[model samples]
Target: MAEKVVMAMSGGVDSSVGAYLLKKQGYDVIGVTMQIWQDEKRCDIEDKGGCCGLSAVEDARKVCADLDIPFYVFNFKQIFKDKVINYFIDEYYLGRTPNPCIACNKHVKWEALLARALFMEAQYIATGHYAKITELKNGRYALQMDFNNPKDQTYALYGLTQFQLKHTLMPLSGIEKDEVRSIAKEIGLKVFNKPDSQEICFISDNNYGGFIEEEGGKKILPGNFVNTDGDIIGKHKGIVHYTVGQRKGLGIAFGKPMFVKEINPLTNEVVLSENKELFSEGLMASDINYMAVESVKEPMEAYAKIRYSHKPVLSEITAQGENILCKFKESQRAVTPGQAAVFYDKDGNILCGGVIERAV
Candidate 1:
């Protein structure tokens, strides 16, 4: 009997073509679209942005039909809200920046969806992420970055559990975006030309402040913008409205340009300074997960990325209990808290990753 695999299709060319590729590899692929969000005001899922909604269901179904595979819609609204949306809001409220996509990947997609896939007797769950999952000789799974592929997604996937990695397959690893789209076009998938989702799916307007307010009745509040010297500069709309490294939309101008260097939720102050002040020697990260190795008992040298689009930098990582301290060889700019800090080896293998706690 052929091994069954569940392909998480997002109504985009990447996932659509990914399903076809897996099926051609002789596996029994079943396509699934996860319905993660729905709001009366933000209902433009059919338009070229974000995943989820009924349109995603329809588009994914059509692709499955073309591939001769079964397709299903998995409702993840509650879990998404609980894990991703709530975490995002709470992080901002705490004056820390959070990556909701990482939360969604860890909770909704892999943890919850993978459980359902296992229930369906599928041996593996796959996505269109441009990262490779390989098993090392030490009997562990590790994620590798494709240096040649510009669309590398290994950063967002570093938080995945070992079990999730072992049961996961990413066929799009090292494949360029253009090549994937070309395959979709050749296969005649209708979503071949669909634009990639840019904004957060639930926030159609890209106004995170508005979304936080609408979903509020939570602790989002207005505060004072201050300088690093603890002197008041201006009034901020709210802590959620501003992030570290933000220069525009401050509504107040200094003699020269000023950037937000820190957000202190306790004092309800947004610390502003010159752009040069954003540079940091190192950062401390909590909630760490290791992939390339079993554990990090001693300090190690590796390349680390603070954000998805950030280039990996040479750094030294030392594990301290539940957290890891990453000291960079060179000064890094805007090392914001609550974002992910993913470490990679020389060959681009994910060594470990965690949520950045502070810039030290």
Candidate 2:
């Protein structure tokens, strides 16, 4: 009997093609779409507006039918709200910018969804993520970037444990997105030409501030904009409306260009300063997950990325109490709080990653 593999289908080209490839490879494939959110005001899933909508569910069902595989929808709305949505709101309220996608990958896809796949006695769970996993000696695994996809998603998957990596299969690791679409077209899948969903799966109109206030039930109050010298320059709309390194929408004209240097949620103050002040020498991160090595015993040189789009910079990381301190070789700008600081080896393999707690 062939091994059963549960495929996480998002009703998009990548996952649609992923299902097709798995079935063709002769695995007893099962397609599963997660119904994570269903808010009419935010996202109309019935209209195929977002990943979790009824439209996406139907599209995934059609693809499974075409491939002659079993299809199912798992309702993860409550778990998603508790884990990802609440965490997003809490981070923003604490004057930090959280990466919801990373949180969803850690708490939703790999955690809750993986558990469900195991419950069905599936040997492995697969997704369309453009990342690769290679098992080293003695059951150790390492996550690496997919060369075919320039938009590497390994940063979002740093939280994956060895157990999860062992049971996970990513079919699109070596396939480019365009090639995935081509395969989808050849396979006659309807979602072959579906435009990629850009917004957060749960946010309706991409109005993050509005959605946070409405759904999170948190009242973001107005505050004062202060400069580096501790002088009040102007009043801000709300502290939550701004982030570090932002310059354009301050609504204050200081004659010289200024950027958001810091945000103090407790004082309800947004600190403005010259663009040069945004650069930092280093940062401290917590909640670290290791992939390449068991642990860092001493200070060592590595390449680190503060955000998803940031180019990895040479750095020296050392253990600091319960957190890891990363000192960049050169100053880095806008090392925002609540963002991930992923460490990589020289060969572009993910070493370990953690939540950035503070800029040093």
Please report, in order, the local distance difference test score of every candidate based on alpha carbons: 0.89, 0.86
- 1-360, model 1: which lDDT tens digit per residue? 889999999988899988999999999999999988656358577674457777777888999999899999999899999999999988888888889999999998899999999999999999988889988878888999888877899999998989999899898987899999999999889889988987788778788887887785675677898899999999998898888899999999899999999998898899999999999999999999999897888999999899998999999999888889999999999998999999998988899999999999
The clash count for each model shown is 0, 3
Q: Where is model 1 more than 4 Å wrong at Cα? A: none
Estimate the lDDT of model 1: 0.89
RMSD of each: 1.1, 1.7
- Tell me the tens digit of each residue's lDDT in model 2 across 106-177: 888989988999999999999988888987664579898653467578888999998999899888887777
Q: Estimate each model's TM-score.
A: 0.98, 0.96
Q: Clashing residue pairs in candidate 1, if any? A: none
The candidate that wins on TM-score is 1
Say which candidate scores most in lDDT: 1
